[model samples]
Each structure stands twice: as C-alpha cells, then as structure tokens.
Target: MVTTLLTPVGDAPWSTEEFESRLRAVPEERYHDRHAFNIRMHSGALSQAELRCWIANRFHYQRHLPVKDALITAKLPTPALRRMWLRRIQDHDGLEEGEGGIERWLRLGEAAGLDRETLLRGDTVLPGVRLAVDGYVNFCRLRPPLEAVAASLTELSAPDLIRTRVAAFERHYPWIDPDGLAYFRSRVPQSRRDGAEALRLVLSWAYTRKDQERAVAALRFACDVLWSLLDAVAHEHCPEGS
Candidate 1:
C-alpha cells in the first residue's frame, strides 16, 4: 500500500527558489482554475443563465479586491512597499468614476443582461461567497504583513487562468460584447507584473523557516478561499439533480 506523507512545515529555511516553488505549488494543488465550475466554463458547457449567475456572484469578489488590497497596504512597513502596492488599488478603483476594473466588470454584468445597479447592490450574493471573500479581506487585515503579501502571491497563477478564460469567452460566449472582455484582457499583464513583485517581497521577507511556513500557509489559505467561492457558485447554479 502506498501512503503520501505531508511535507512538514518549518523543516528548514528554504532557499529563494525553494520558497517560490512551495508558493507556486499551492496553485497546482488547489487553484480555482481546477474547479468543476471553471472546467465547465472553459468547455462552454455552462448555460447562459448559469453564466449570468457566475458574473453576478463573482462581482462581489471583484468589488472586494480593492478592500483587501487596502488592508494589505495598511500593513506594509515601508513607504516603498506602500507606494508599490497602491497601484493595485488604482488598477481596481481607478482615478475617477466610469473607469477601472470595477467599471469593466459592471459592463460585463450588463452584457450578461444583469442590471448594473442590481449587481452593485449585491443583494443576490451568496452567503458562502460573502464568507469566502470576507475571509480573504479579514485575513489580510489580521495577518502579518509578510503573510498577507504571500497571500497575494496567488496572482502568480492568475495570468494563465485569465488567458484561458479570455480564449473561452471569445470562442464560446460570443453573445457577450467584445468590450465586456476588457477585464480579463487587462488582467493578463497586470497579474504577471503584480505576481512578480509579490513573489519578490515574499522571498525577501520570509527569510526564516517559520516565516517561510507562515507565508506558505497564507498562500494556501488564499487558494482555499478562492476554491470555496467557486464551490458556492457551483452548488447554487449547478446542483447535482439539476
């Protein structure tokens, strides 16, 4: 019989490469890209209603991204880190009204036939989605800055997922306006840049073995939060009997 042994945390201080590998490994095992909902989405198996529900539910997550970033920003110890991290806020919130990723997502909601006002209202957000998204925000708020920075390393896997999603949208969901795809298109490059910076910060800050373990644990928590969000969406929109 074969049994798998868990890799014990705090075994030793990881080299930069090893630490990065451990961080990247979380996505391999737990990224939402592997979720059943995303697989169906990529395969074009989701119905239009299902797609709309996903957009509406995911908007809650998108809207909270800046909030989480802000929490992380508050924990940064240096002005340089704060300055560097502030761009993430600007990327989501923009300099003015009618701009930024949030606006683009509202357009996506409109393209999906949802009312922009209604999506913003968020009355339809699932309780589990709320818990998952809120859990992410609170984790950033409460954890050590290094762990919070590590949590954002989930961006490392995001560029690939965004690329796959963009292709899936273009190939299968042509009913959505091309303009509505701007959110995913914009994220491809942004996530790459952000992920690189975040990985650098995590590698620099988590120099001790226990610190490295905490960073890895933070990243795993983020992956689980994202997976839970999708699980909630799947349970609601793709129930087994249906």
Candidate 2:
C-alpha cells in the first residue's frame, strides 16, 4: 500500500505552488487513511488478530522500502541528491542490524505476539499484499527517477497518519507495549524531513507539463497501492465477534 498517478486533464505545467497543490490533492481523497480497515483501526475497533495481521502484513512493505530506496538512490543524478536520499535507506535498514526501522518493526511484530522468524519468513503474507508491495518496488525500479521519487511522496501524508495511529494505539490498544510503537514515533519527524526533500526534488525536476502531470499520476498510483493493501488485509481478516 506504500507504493508510489493522475491528471486534472490540464494541458500546461503548473506554477510551483500549483504543482505542489496538485500533488497534495491526490491523498486528500485517495489516501488509505480513509480505508475502512484504517478507519476501524483509528476507532480502536480492531481485534487483536486484526491488529497483528496489519502489523505483520505491513512488514512485507516495510522490508522492501530499502530495496526500492536503493533503486532510487542509484538513479539520483547528483551526489547532493544521492546523499540526501541515502538517509532514507539507512533510516529503514539501519546503520547496522538490530537497529533502524526494519528491526523496530520486527519488534512491533513480536509485541503483537508474532515470532520474529515467522514474520521474516512471511508465510502468512497474503498474495495480494505481496503483489501490491512488489508493484511498489518495480515502480521505483522502472519509472523515471522523477516519478519514482514522487511515488515516495506518500511520505507527505505520513506524519499526520503516524501521529493519529500512535495516539490510537496508545488510547485503544493498551495491550500493545508502548515501546513497540517506536517505528511510528520515529517516522513522525523522519517523514516530515523526507517529505520536504521529496517535494523539493519533485518541484525542481518536474519542470515541464508532462513531468508535472507524471508526478501527480505517480502520487495517485501510490494512493492506489495503499488502498489495495488495506483491501487485502480487510478481506482476509475479520474483526472479533463478527
């Protein structure tokens, strides 16, 4: 669901604010924050199993983040951009093992009563989750660097979502160790920093009408990836006492 499209049917490139506005608009309607499962989650209505399902399945996407980021890192045209982007990969993968976002997520899995090896093995990962996550990786691999980076623009909406998610978990799911929430906590500031850099790159590189449109299209596509992920999760896991 974290992959990284659309047009307003316009014929010209927009001004800087207008271009950024268009990018922001996609998530307004399409962000997975509005998904039924996520809405249920925010309401603190999800059962323990449902929450564990989300935690484990999201790990599928989480593990691939560095892979796709590495692809983006390779495509960055300059050392300055590359250096800026390398932090994203490191943030997820960590400077060393037993550190960073991926490890923190494994801890999240453990806190949800999932075994680290089992989550890493991915035996329970649904076909749809795999497909959607793989699509996200291929997107970064094959698309223009501009579009690839734009796809990551999902980070633009992430800080707020993480904020609400953390609060919801703390409020509604007290059974989960607050310590397990580090990944979400860390991402609030990290996403903000990353979102700013990504928007800058998108604005600086997407100078033409076509590229601007492609950026928007990529954002919409990212939105779809997130929605599809939730659909799969919701379909497979029924809430308690349903």
* Top-scoring candidate (TM-score): 2
Tell me the number of clashing residue pairs for each predicted model: 0, 7
lDDT (CA) per prediction: 0.89, 0.91
Candidate No. with top lDDT: 2
For each candidate, what TM-score against the reference? 0.93, 0.93
- Pairs clashing in candidate 2? 1-225, 1-226, 5-217, 5-218, 5-220, 5-221, 6-217
Which residue segments of model 2 deviate by more than 4 Å? 1-10, 238-242
Model 1 misplacement above 4 A:
1-10, 238-242
Tens-digit lDDT track of model 1 for 39-76: 99999998887888789889999999999999999888
